[model samples]
Target: MEWDWNFVRQIMPVLVQGVKITILATLLGSILAAAVGLVIALGRRSDNRIVARSIGLIAEFIRGTPLLVQLYFIFYVLPDVGILLPPLLAGVIGLGVHYGTYTAEVYRAGIDNVPRGQWEAAKACNLSSRQTWTRIILPQAIPPMIPALANYFIGMFKETPLLSAITVLELMNQAKIVANSYYRYLEPITLVGAFFLAISLIAVVLMRWLEQRYGRIEP
Candidate 1:
């Protein structure tokens, strides 16, 4: 079939709308992931073995399961237990929780890289635990963590398509709707690819900026 500029034009608005949903989901999901991942990371580093082990087990369990299955459980299974989340909320939570596990590991690695002497010095100074972590450990540990966190942001963006499986009207879901309604897959699918590529390119640029900014300070 000949490429139809008219078809592309007609679907442009729909694709744009879908892109909005995609961005919103990514932003919300990333925020939640960052907050929860930090908690998990700190928990894994706790002096208490029980706290550390419990958080470690949770992070491992989430990483071990497929994100799609997690999404299904949140969207489909949880409702039976009286935890009903809207599709968008469920999608965001699934994405956040799945990637939060990965980011938690990233945080652990970053924290581990902090010089052992720093911790000793903090203790030598009689710094409280909170002061040691917030003032010394995190200030140093966080810069290296930025790149990993930014990478996860891009990964989460790509994975947003999975939300379509649960009927979240993200970019891919919107494309499916357009394709089904018009019985034309070419334009909508191609548009989806273009949208993803464009966003991925933007993300790459942003990641590089973050890397450069953080790398100089920490590396």
Candidate 2:
């Protein structure tokens, strides 16, 4: 078939709307992931074995399961249990919880890499635990985490398509809808691919800039 400039122009608005949904999901999901992951990471590092072990088990469970299944469970099954959530909310929660496990590990690794002497120095100075973490450990640990966190944000962007499984109508979902309705998969699908690639390239460039900034801060 010949290239269809007219078709491309017609579908551009739909594609733009889909891109908006994708970005919204990614931003919201990343925020949730970051907040939840910090809690999980802290729990895993707790002095209490029960807290640590429980967080560890929960993180493992999340990481062990496929995100699609989690989305289905949240979107489809929860209503039966009286916790009905809207499709978009459920999608965000599912994606957030799924990626939170990964982000928890990233946080844990960063905290662990903080030199032991930092902790010792904090103790020697009689710093309270909160002071030690906020003033010393986190200051050192969080910079190293910037690059990994950026990667997770990018990963979340790609994973927004999984929300389509839950009927959230993100980028891929919109593309599929357009293709099915018009029986023209070529332009829509090609546009979707190009959109993802362009966004991903921009994300990578931003991430590299963040990595350099963080590197300088750490060094």
- TM agreement with the true structure for every prediction: 0.95, 0.95
Scored against the true structure, residue 13 in model 2 reaches a CA lDDT of: 93
lDDT of 2: 0.89
Return the number of clashes found in candidate 1. 0
Candidate 2, residue 6: how far the Cα is off, in Å? 0.8
Q: Could you give candidate 1's per-residue lDDT for residues 1-219 as a string of tens digits?
A: 777999999999988999999999999999999988999999987899999999899889999999999999999999999999999999999999899988887788888899999999999999999999999999999888898888988999999999999999999999999999999999899889999999999999988998888872221
For model 2 the local lDDT of residue 213 reads 85
| Model 2: CA > 4 A from native | 216-219
* Top-lDDT candidate index: 1
The candidate 1 region of ten consecutive residues with least summed lDDT is: 210-219
Q: What is the lDDT, from 0 to 100, of the residue 144 in candidate 2?
A: 80
Task: Write the residue-wise lDDT of candidate 2 on 99-131 in tens digits.
Answer: 889888888888988899999999999999999
Pairs clashing in candidate 2? none
